[model samples]
Target: MARLLLLGAGHAHMTVMAHLPEIISRGHTVTAVGPLSRHYYSGMGPGMLGGTYTPEDISFPVQQMIESRGGEFILDKAVRVDAKSKKVLLQSGREIEYDVCSFNTGSSVPQSIVNANATDVYSVKPIENLLAGRKRIQSLADRGKISIGVVGGGPAALEVAGNAAACAREAGCKNVSVRLYAGKVFLRHLSPRVRSLCASAMRKHAIQIIEGSYASGVATKKVTLEDGREFDEDVIFIAMGVRPSALIAESGLPVGNDGGLAVNRFLQCDEHPDIFGGGDCIWFKDQPLDKVGVYAVRQNPVLYHNLIARMEGGELQPFDPGGEYLLIFNTGGGTGVLHKAGISFGGRLAFFIKDYIDRKFMREFQP
Candidate 1:
């Protein structure tokens, strides 16, 4: 029986977990590793921060799901992969030998720009960090006025800024203020119409959108701009986007310019066909994809099929990223900005659509 190793309890691996019984019945052993037993759906993370959803609402019991399906689960972080030895090294000094391996390790927010010792400085990643920041912000706002700073020009920054304001307001803080430090023009990569709608929504929420300069440094309750300006705040969120985990590159595997595991159209590493990956952790050689969950969700079935195919010497299937995906941003205050196929709009209806889709996605994956 061949051994299969799955890394990270991310979107693409969810399908593998669901079909673990079938894989085991086919004479293969499955083992999954992740830092956390529960996998939180990032799409609903902002809602959790804004008190629209609880931690339980957006998380999946990954460990339980794996064990129930007759698969082994390891609650440890993978530090490196010895591709030549066909082994994966864990932080705890454990080595797992696998005939086939796949990565869905996700990504992390770059924290180098922020002071490591700074307090109340949060990164818009790990999803759980937002919950802690929410509690801290609410506790501080319970006393008096507070100013929050959000650094980044992407959708993640907008979501955090708006939801943080909503969180403070829900705590009955009447003097809560939010400022978004959008480097250069906000949403520079998006359509002008989407940018206008987003800006309007920010203004409606009394959020100050600061552009022209990027945040050069982030410290406790203070942010220094590249243009030599400074702003003091009660809390700061560093949403400077995300980067793939360094494990793949550190393991001496082939990677793309973004440091993601480089994979071919079949989602297999060209140099090592037995090694496969998807999600934000992989760079598809055919085309560069946005680091969004939609692509990972699409790669699910293909990864599942190919992993089994490799073991059985069957033909592998090529992954098609598909057509335009619907993009929705829950910008707090019970509103959202949605864009799909050149159609863009904003308001409560958009939020409802996003909410319905997110909840449905959770239901489908949650065991």
Candidate 2:
């Protein structure tokens, strides 16, 4: 039996955990490792700020699920990979040898804005950080008016701004204010109509929007822009997207210009077949996929099948990520927006659809 080591409890890896029985039935010993006890669905991240779901509602207990499936679960972070030795180094100063390994560690928040006066600045990552930021906002609301600043203008930032506004209102803070610094352009990834709709929603909630500039520095209570303009910000949330996880690049694996691990058609490391990867951490030029949840979700079945095949010495299957997929944004208050290709729509129905899909996905990992 081959020893299969699955790294990270990310969306893709969690799928593998759910199918541990299938892998074990083939005479393979599976071990899953990560730092978090539970895995949060990023789709419900906006729901977190909007008071629709708690951490428990959006996350699944990783360790419990793996253990129930009779697979080993280690709650430790992977810091290094010795491809030549076929071993993984953990943060606890231990190492594990494996016949095969798959990484779905997701991405890390970029620290370009980290500075000496970045006390009140927080990076939105690991999901737990967002929960902690929510608590901090709730607590600070009791003191006085709260100035919430969001950096980034993508779909994620839009959802965060809207949900945060709703959260502030639900917390009984009437003087809550939100400012979105959408570096350069706003919603450039969406169609013009969709962008207009999103901008309208933020404006309706009185979220101050700033365009054509990025945050140059952050202070304890202020954010300075590249144009030398500054604003008082009580709390700043960094949602400026993510970069590849450092473990992949540091492992001396082939990586893309973006630092994401270079993977081939079968999701195997371009340089090492025994080491495979998927999710936000991988970059496959032939099947270039966006660093989004939808691709990772779709890759689960393929990854699972290929891993089993690789162990059985069977032919590998190629992965092809087809054209555009739907993009939905929960705009708080049981309303949301949906966009795909050149089409766009918004309503409570959209939110319901997103909620149903998210719940269904989370249910698969539930005990």
Candidate 3:
């Protein structure tokens, strides 16, 4: 039986879990390694902060789901991958041998930036970090003085800033304030209309928008901008871009300029066919994909099929992202904006659509 080892219980891996029964029936053993037993769906993060969903509502109990699907679930972090040796090194000092391996470990903010503002910087990747940051802001707001500084101009930063403002208001803090440091061009990827709507929502929520400069560094009491301006911020959240785990580059794998593992259309590592990766960790050679859940979610089915095909000595399927996907930005208080193909719209209806889609997606992984 071929041994198939999965690194990280990310969204794509969850799809693999859904197909585990068939893979096991075909005579292959499956094992998943990750530090957490539950994987939080990042789509609901804004709602989570807005008090619309709890952690449990957006997370999948991966161990339970994997075990129920007849797969081994290891609660350990994968530190290294010896592709030539077909082995994966875990944090617990165990080396697991495998015939084939796939990575969906996701990405994180650069350590340099984290360290530059370690005193107040909180990342949004782990979900827990954002939650803790939310609680800290709440506590400070309750005490009567709070200022939130968010870095990055992408969806994550916008969602975080908007909902965080709403969270503070819901906590009854009249002294709360939020400021967004949108480097140079804010939401450059989104349509102009969507950008305008987002700006309006931020305005409505009382969040300040500062464009034309990026954050240079963060101090305990304020954040410094590249343009030599400083804002007094009690807390700073770094939602800037994320890069793949250092293990990929450290393992001698071919990577993209952005530090993500380089993969072909088949989703296999270019230099190592037996090794595969998808989701945020992979940089597709044909088309550069944004590090967004929309792309990751689309890769799920393709990764599922290709992994099974590799183990069964069958043909692998190719992945094509096609075109830009729709995006929904929740601005809290039963309001949201939808962006697709350069067109944008929003209202109470948009929020309901977003809530329905997110809830349905989360329900699929429930035991």
User: Per-prediction TM-score, please?
Assistant: 0.99, 0.97, 0.96
Q: lDDT of candidate 2?
A: 0.85
Q: Using lDDT as the measure, what is the rank order of every candidate, best first? A: 1, 2, 3
Stretches > 4 Å off in candidate 1: none
TM-score of 3: 0.96
Ranking by TM-score: 1, 2, 3
lDDT of 1: 0.93
Which candidate number has the best lDDT?
1
The sequence of per-residue lDDT tens digits that candidate 1 reaches over residues 302-361 is 999999999999999999999989999999988999999999999999999999999998
List, residue by residue over 1-367, the lDDT tens digit for candidate 3.
8999999988877788888898899899999998898898888887788777888998999999889999999999988899988998898999899998999989887545444535756777787677787787777777776888888888888888988887787788888789988999888887789999988888888889899988887667677888899888888888887888878998888999888899999999878889999888888898888888878788889998998888888999999887867788888767888977766887778789899998998887677
Better of 1 and 3 by TM-score: 1
Q: Which RMSD values do the candidates have, in order?
A: 0.7, 1.3, 1.5
Quantify all predictions' global Cα lDDT against the true fold. Answer: 0.93, 0.85, 0.84
Judging by TM-score, tell me the better candidate of 2 and 3. 2
RMSD of 2: 1.3
